[model samples]
Target: MTDRHDHPAAFVDDMSDRAEQIADAAMRLFARYGFKRTAVDDIAKEARIAKATIYLHFKGKDDILRATLQLLGQRVDALCREVMEMKAPFAERLMALLRAHHCTAFLSIGAGDHFAELRAVIDDIAVKERKAFESIFVRYATQLIEECEARGEITLKRPGVDPAALITTLMQASVGAKVGGISYEDYEARLGLFAGVIIAAVLP
Candidate 1:
């Protein structure tokens, strides 16, 4: 007789794998021509499968998007966790995680006239998603800040810099670099210096 736990576990694993594949396909298509212009047909073609097959897995295009964004959120959490697990200095781990997020995932997905609609969706979804991301970033950043203070890497006289403000600054800087056409090499150099400065500023 088949063990009930074994069957359920296998079924869940298979579903997760399939969902991930679908998300990957959706990302590629959406990246090519913004999510608004991409159709289920486009995703189906990219995935090399029938449109009906997509329906079997997801409710529709919106469902596909929800899944893709959710996957990204999970990945961000995992990256933060990895950085936190590193034995190096807290500042080093934070820099590594910041650098990882600096690169844009879907280059072709631009704002253009699609900004309003997309922004609305993101704002609503992000209200929830951003909190989760912030929790991860703050947890890691706070630990690093504490470590740096103990080692005299920073000289914070009081509470020092807010972790949320630091994360926002780094994110804005990266976005500005992307907008200004900064080369990867230049961005990396600048990011390193910026990270170091932030560490020093917050260290007490």
Candidate 2:
């Protein structure tokens, strides 16, 4: 039976499907070839679409790269929010935050030699977008730090700890597991020790 409602709905669904297909194709090619080496032709081939069809969706290779990265950053922000929103203890929230980063799509995409290009691309983002990304990290980390402080889990001196500095330190320390040769397990263990030390230093 033909349905009148199906036409518009089907068109929207088709558009969504094609968009996802193109994005997925871009991700795959970019992962393999990095931003500098990945061309519109590579993405089109990976997507099984003509070059013109690729242009119909994305302006060019840079557009595709930006779209892919923005998508990844959004997912990271979401995961961080989920951890912050959890009803668990401070330690558990910290664990969830670490776990989220450990298993995120961004991490998967950042693996291999191509990851340097990903960092370079991030460095190239507009100042506003870059600041927004920084704010997201700060927001999540500040919440975790406050939770730790409230629970007397961390001690601060009379001068007190700078929440922003602590957050940045922890985050950069966490990244060491990635771009460095250290394994996640080792990094996590070290992080636990670092957390303990930080808490002891900050708590009354």
Backbone steric clashes in candidate 1, count: 5
Tell me the spans in candidate 2 whose CA falls farther than 4 Å from its real position: 1-17, 102-106, 125-131, 147-160, 181-204
Top-lDDT structure, candidate number: 2
Off by over 4 Å in 1: 1-6, 104-121, 124-127, 150-155, 158-160, 180-190
- Report how far residue 180 has shifted in candidate 1, in Å: 4.1
- In the range 1-204, model 1's lDDT, one tens digit per residue, is 885477998988877877877877886666556677889999888878788878878998878877766676677667667776778865677677775444332232222334344436655654565355445555666666666667777656756466667767776565444444445667667677778878777654
Q: Give the alpha carbon lDDT tens digit for every residue of 39-127 in model 2.
A: 88888888888889877777777667666655556767889988888887666677677656543643446556676676678578534
Per-model TM-score, in order, reads 0.73, 0.73
lDDT score of residue 148 within candidate 2: 71
